[model samples]
Target: MTLHQRPSLQSVPAYKQGKPAAAGASKLSSNESPHSPLPSVLDAISEGLGTIHRYPSIAAPQLTAELAALHQVDPQHITLGAGSVEVAAQLIHAVAAEGDEVMYAWRSFEAYPSLVRIAGATPVEVPLDADSKHDLPAMLAAVTEKTRLIFICNPNNPTGTVVEAKALEDFIAAVPRDVLIVIDEAYVHFDRSAVRADGVELFKNNPNVAVLHTFSKAYGLAGLRIGYAISPLEVAENLRKVAIPFGVSDLAQRAAVASLHAADELSVRINEVVAQRERMYEALEVAGYPVVKSQANFVWINAGDDTLDIEAKLADGGVVVRAFPGDGLRISSGSELDVDRVIAALASVREGAQA
Candidate 1:
């Protein structure tokens, strides 16, 4: 039987977070680091847990202050959320009314389109270029009077492509004043290349632009689900209003604050991931797979792309990666062991092609 559906209740495509692999399998699917929370961060969370019987400081004052100081912005300029993804959704919900349109690049964050839909808004998806980077000009052209929000995911998820600062600056200039622009930089710290947008700097100037950042990536705090948005106070207040109360847990708030001080240590570890990403890219390219220049922790495999089929084969080889149907697989990546595992799995596929 066909199910009756309201426009808001229609089947909005869901974000496909990958399944966890078997205990011994190297899981590289969810873009989660193979690593765990830092020892100090773990200690911080443990300390916070002792106070769990009490409701966390809903304001997250200490955490927010640390974030404000780090970003060189006022605490009032920030709104903490469960993760940067949640912050992104809040930004859309803040500026858009039901049926108003939100625009973003396709295959960017699998979540963006669905999140907009769930907010009772229309999602406009502009396709990425052949190179897999966002076609910003085309996206700008698609913006309409109903376009209340635009999402720009730098070093975009799944595709791992980035918009350089110059291009980003140009794109921002063309955006209408009435529209809210969200720059999702969930994996920014993992990026070492110079060709990337500094959303923080952009937010410091443009009241219309809101930037979402998270400690999940380089800080090894994904489990804490701690992230925040930098926006004008007007926008920040709106986001805070729409947010579910106390979404940022006490432990998460505390751990994220501690993690912020470990940047020097995290940078060294992140550089290692960057090097491994380059190696993974080289290996895939050498084996004749189409790869985008990755500026994120993972590399995208555009395997022409039997994404699901390829994923199954990698699974047999004990490596779990993310598959996006026609877009191929996104290998969340790891150190030498994790990288080598995926390379071997893809290599086996390449060798079989010739057979």
Candidate 2:
């Protein structure tokens, strides 16, 4: 007899990571920081090496306290997870059930649908607007009685588009009090827009709102896998209930704390990434690609029918980018050299098409 599996998983596909670069190619496929860990962060990780045999502090009190102080929230409001994605899963399981619905923008985070499906909840995906930003009005319209959760991915992944502050405020006010709204700010540090929505600020007066943050992106702690959520006291408790025991390793916790304390050093790296992102956006536009103005550490090229062809051309030119088949391509901002390679590759594509 065949071993039993959940019927819901039958249609769900496994998550696909961005492709690794071939020899001599610049890997821009993954939205990862190109910088190495700071000396302070490395020292902290080294100090924790002796504690490997023991399980990490389940509550991660030190890191939790640091995060609370950083966000100006009480420690009770914080919950730690292996990563923000895991925190997202905990949030889904905390409030959603078999028939409950979880809503988000389509082509936002690729993991949303699978996470909801794994929780046995129905996924509600609204399409992005023409500018590739979240269609908040349409998302509000799609909410129903069964809607238990809504995720707004600010500076949305792959597209690098963000919802403005005022519009997001209105959307939050209009959402039902009982429906949990999670503002996933995985790329929050890279967003420098004047009107960018602050998730922590939004969560202050709104008990139904939660803010998710990760050390993976700006802090360059992706390999360590540490992230947290600031939410209502009750929501935090439930999130803790659903989280895996000792999911966050001791080294990750130490690295996150060290990274936070070394904020000045971290800021320099972030500024470098932002600079590169701007350079890339400008170059892509000059090459005749209708690139979106990204506030995150990447730019979106809406390649449409030419996506695959462009992907192949980029490969030939020793550069790699994340392609969304018929939709577009998302190129992570790497070093100055990487941006040069990407510009050269796309220039070749444009020249070939014109020829």
Candidate 3:
């Protein structure tokens, strides 16, 4: 007899990781920090190797306290997960179940649909606006009695478009108090916009709001897989309940703590990344592509049907970028050489298109 599996799982799509580049090509497929880990972070990780035989602290008390102090929130409101994505999954399970609905912007995060379906909730997707930002008005209109949770990816993945502060605050005020609003601020550090929504501040006044952050992005800790949520005390408690035992490793916890201490160094690195992102956005626009105004560490080119063709050309030019097939392309801001190669590749592709 064939082994039994959950029927819902058969239709669930596996998460697709960014493709790796060949030798000599710059891999900007993943929106990761181009800079190396701070020396202090490296030292912390090396020191943690001494405890290889022991299990990591289940509570991760020290790291939790540091984060609490940093955000000026009660430690009770903080919850750690393997990554923010894992925390998102936990939150979906905590609030929604069979027959319930989880809502988010379509093309916001590729993982949203899979996460909702895994929790046995129906995924309700609202399409993005013409500019590629979340259509919050439409998203709020889609909210039905069955809607339990909504995810708003600020500086949304793949597009790097943000819903400005005033607009976002208004949307929060209008949303039903019972429905949880998850502000996925994964790219907040790179956002230089004057009107960017402060997710942490928003979470404090609104008990129904939860802010998901990841060490994987700004802190250069993708391999370590450490992330956390600033949520209401009850939600935080439930997140802990669903968390995998010994999920945050000793190295990850210590490294994150050290990284938090080196804020000045991180700020300098972040500024450089932001500068590069702006340069890349402008360069793409001048090169004749319809590039979105990005506030994150990546630029989005609305290539539509030409995505694959441009992606192949970029790959041939020793540069790699993430392409969303028929949607567009997402290219991470990297070193100067990487940016130069991207410009050249884009110019070459546009010329070929015209011919």
Which residue pairs come into collision in candidate 2?
none
Error of 1 at 325 (Å): 0.9
Candidate 3 residue-wise lDDT, 1-355, digit = tens: 9999899998799998888988888989999888888999999999988888999997899999999999999999998888899989989988897989999998888999999998899999999999898998999899999999999999899899998889999999998899999999999999888788899999988869999999988888988999999998888888888888888899999999999999899998889888888888998888789999998889998889989999999998999889999999999999888898999988898888789
Tell me the TM-score of each prediction against the true structure.
0.96, 0.99, 0.98
Ranking by TM-score: 2, 3, 1
Candidate 2 local lDDT, residue 269: 95
lDDT of 2 by residue, 167-237 (tens): 99999999999999999999999998878899999999897999999999999999999889999999999
Score candidate 1 by lDDT.
0.86
lDDT ranking, high to low: 2, 3, 1
Residue 10 Cα positional deviation in candidate 1, in Å, after optimal superposition: 2.9
Candidate 2 backbone clash number: 0
* Residue 200 displacement (Å), model 1: 1.0
lDDT of each: 0.86, 0.93, 0.91
lDDT score, residue 204, model 2? 96
Better of 1 and 2 by TM-score: 2
* Per-residue C-alpha lDDT of model 1 across residues 1-355, encoded as one tens digit per residue: 9977776555687676677889888888888766766788888988977788887776899988988888899999999889988888888888888889999998888888788888888889999998999899999999998999899998899888989899988998999988888899988987877879899999887868888888888888888788899998999998889887888899898888888877777778888888889999999999988888798999998875577778887998999888878767889868789888889998998888789
Segments of candidate 2 deviating more than 4 angstroms: none
Q: Which candidate is the best by lDDT?
A: 2
